[model samples]
Target: MLGRPVSLIEADDASNVDTAIKAATKLVKDDRVDFLMGTFNGDVAIAVSEFAKQENRLFMVTGAHIMDLTGSRCNSHTFVFMPNARMMAQAVVPHIVKAYGNKWFMITADTVDGKAALQAMTEALKAQGGDVVGSVTTAFGATDFTAPLMEAKNAKPGAVILNLYGWDLVHALKAYTKLELAKEKIGVGGMIGGEQIGRPLGYANNAGVWGLIWDPKINTEGSKRFIQGVIDKYNHTPTSRCYHGYAAMMQVLEAVRRAGTTDTAAVIKALEGHEFDGLKEGRSYFRAWDHQHVQDVLVGEAYGKELGLGHYKILATVPGDAVAGGVEQNQCRL
Candidate 1:
């Protein structure tokens, strides 16, 4: 997109904040990378954002949804590509309220990301006159969900919101199905859910309506092409992580083109408030106040193959502005 030779450098933070900071700082100090991207979860992302601020280098966040990234922890050098926790809650909770009732049970991973997402969802649900009936916190990698599911079953929430991800989400959903929570009229949802969960479990097993950043089948020319391209290259549907990488690359390349240089200040200036097409969403921009990208989100319901729907079907298209809340909603002062 920049129409020029671009260099790439990569590192593994091993999911540790201190390791991430050390590794990122080395890249910036050695002048080996023009910009940095990533840290899978929120705690490491916050540390990496601090590193970008101290070093005065660009850090484009790829996958980390903690509200603080673009909220209180936001910095001029850090721009976020993916939606934050609040955005995820806004994208899915209202629908959950309308369809599944206001009473909810929360199963959260005990991490900053998990807690932040749960808080966001709680606030959104409360705004709709909904409330949490029960809650459970789990260690991030724990596979057994029997205890939590049993607690949720006893609580008899109208819905179960899993503020869990990766293998945690996978295991919980499988257990939820095994226990037949749906038979008790207990619906399932999550702050974040994706093909990662749906693809493996199949729609019948994966019962819920949830928020998603992007879906290959979303009705957009750019999204269709992006999905097809990934299929051709990877021989599988792209994950939300892949979408984040593609979106971040597009934004950074566009910023470089507009700035005409790799200077951090110039690129940052170019990106702030700049709007463009090509995102899976119709159009998106970097909000100048918080450096969070504003874009639409998908609300999808898991549907079985028997229903003639692929893994999940889009239920609503929540506009970015509708879900973005406002500057007042953000804790970022700059």
Candidate 2:
């Protein structure tokens, strides 16, 4: 690694598409950064990618999982390092069906990404001979989920799949507890839930089958070392977003190193269809067809509280190639 200092430009005003584009444009016009990254918002991510292509700068999607990010909306300047909604549904639905039952009730976040995930999950269920018993859509930042939780409780489906993330997920879990849904022995699953919401509640409350994009405790030498290094540096455990950021940075660095220059085109060439080690998933690579990172999707169980932060007992390791859809499924032209 070079000793040269890497400058960081923070964009606190990235709440909307217009603001996100403006912040990125300012960085390229003023600081002249080699590339750009981030934006957890799906619409904002698409706007930023358009900026990247127009500016001839590479952009790595470190967060956000709108299927279109790597599907119809993908571009030459954008590469997605995180799994998308479709991948999440395919990886977790089978496990949910086997563990719980065929009937499901979905309480989904009201957003484009949320809608896409719901559709993908619905298709997965149909393919597996499972069925959706009932469903409800809620606003993105709604604080109270009592009404929906009560409705879902009465429906009495075999399980409830939360198509929620971030604060929405936390709110729904607390409401689920307060409403005494757990007393009925009904199970809860999530298409996009992780340690950010689970750790605070501990295993006893968060216990169940769930999908995870990454885990710091995966059994591998590289995984253990990477997890330890983060703890040593940050004095805390890593979240799924932390793992996503790390993997994206690592890929960028590797591309630059292999390309032997910071030129965007060369770096992009170096990354696509290239396999590499160091990820917790024994191996990983960016698909040339769509720029989606192909790696294992983990299904884990939290049976007890002592598993600790960033820890979960693996229920299954869904193969990356098997889960990452093929070219027929890929819509990206680039």
Candidate 3:
């Protein structure tokens, strides 16, 4: 392991993200935490990013998949470590397009995030020769799926792709099953539709769901050791959240060594053309033009009994550049 001094802290972003901002502001203003990391909710990440910019600390995000963290909201001091919304859509375009071309009805959450997920997926659908027949949007954690799933059931979509993630998606699955929205006639899939989201879906529900991931539970040369490091360090195997967070740290650490100073500008310059040493995608880097880090994507299906982990399934690597979210000038205003 490379010798470095890395201190870790968890901002109480989960309790109230505003509290995360106050904590981050204090670290940057008082303690001067060399680099600010985390508070993964995009809104929290954005707040901290602004603080980082004002204080000249580096705000490197681990896995707050919102597109704006890098898209419209990017700043000189704010950098994303993991893939974003556009990247997610890009990763799965080929599979969804090729496997189930045409007719999609999105059962998206009635929240900002759901809207973004729906947007990214719709863009992907259009790219692969499909049309959104209609969509049903519900609140972030709406308990009732009777209305939405029933609409989806009647729409008779060639596919019904959900945009929800984590626990919300789990309830949505239960509601879908309860509403008798589970359709064998129509192909169904969605982001976070695999092990993490699938585990609660159970064997019967997860059996047919598919998804895209950055890593899989398979034996590969570097992966074995890499995963072991995660397990040893965190007392558990790395979740996508954990792996991407580590990857982001690795990127910033590399930039620090290259720059020899945590001066925001210097590190920014160092990261511009740098190649990160990730375990799965051994050599990865961001394009200077858009700060889009190119890396591997995987296609997987839910299988066997889930160990109540973040995600569990056998995954196959897709072509690294499978989705192709355009990279040149970003939408970031600044």
Candidate 4:
């Protein structure tokens, strides 16, 4: 896209903030990379973003969902490609309230990302006239959810929100299934889930109405093409995480092409307020003020068995504009 050969250098951040900053420094000073992308942890992403700003490099966050990245900590050098906790909560909370109930309980991982999800979901639920009856925080990677799940069940909430991701989410779902919480008429869900979590948890244990970043069932031509491309190369269906990496990189490269140079300032200007094919059914764009990627957020219900290409049956495709708060609401000065 820059009209010259580009070299990609990747370094594992080890999900640690210091490691991420050190790796980013090497990529900038040693590898001399012009742009940085990809970090899943909110803390790591934020750290790398600060580094990017100091070093004058563009960093595209692919997986982190913390709102601060595009809110209080927002900077011109950093762009978030994944939906934030607020967006996902606003998109799914209404559906969850309607399908499950107004009273909810939460088992949240005690990290910035998890706390963001807890707050977003709580606010979104309260906005819908719902309330969080109870909540408990667990360590970020806690394996045993017995205490929190039991406490949640004792509260007898109409639904439970698992504000977690990765294996933490997987293990929580397993414990929920083991407890047979659904049989008691208690619904469960969270801010995000898809093939990445479901594949590991398996269909039998994957239950609830959850937010999905992307699913194979989306019928858009771009979605079809992206899915096919992944299948061709990886021989496996692409997950939401896969889509985040691909889409974020595509946008960055496209911005570089439009700017006709890899100059950081020009690329940032090219990306701000830019609209593109999100590979989903919605108008996707980076809000000029916050640089958050606004797109469709899918609400899906997990079944005991697979339906089509995934475990979740899509329930709603909420438009980005319908849920993404206005610039004033986002509190982003830039």
Per candidate, the number of residue pairs that clash is 0, 0, 4, 0
lDDT, residue 302, candidate 2: 56
Per-residue alpha-carbon lDDT of candidate 1 for residues 100-173, written as tens digits (9 for 90 to 100): 89999999999998999889999999989888999989998989998999999999899999998888898999
Ranking by lDDT: 4, 1, 2, 3
After superposition, candidate 4 runs with Cα above 4 Å error: none
Superposition error at 332 for model 1 (Å):
0.9
- Note the Cα lDDT for every prediction shown: 0.85, 0.81, 0.67, 0.91
Error of 2 at 75 (Å): 0.6
| Best-performing candidate as measured by lDDT | 4
Pick by lDDT: 1 or 4, better one: 4
Best candidate according to TM-score: 4
* Positional deviation of residue 139's Cα in model 4 after best superposition, in angstroms: 0.8
Backbone clashes in model 1: 0
Candidate 1 Cα deviation (angstroms), residue 316: 0.5
Ranking by TM-score: 4, 2, 1, 3
Question: What CA RMSD would you report for each candidate?
Answer: 1.9, 1.7, 3.3, 1.1
> Over the stretch 195-295, how does candidate 4's per-residue lDDT look in tens digits?
88888876788999999999999999999999999999999999998999889888988998999999999999999999999999999999888999999
Candidate 2's residue-wise lDDT over 1-334, tens digit each? 3445666677754448888887998889988999897878788888899889999999998778888988899999999887787787888888888888879999999887678778988988898998888999999998999999888988998788888887788888878877778688678886766777776666456755777888766777777777788899998788888888777888888898898888999999999999876366646888888888888888887554546555567778787888888999778898
TM-score of each: 0.94, 0.95, 0.85, 0.98
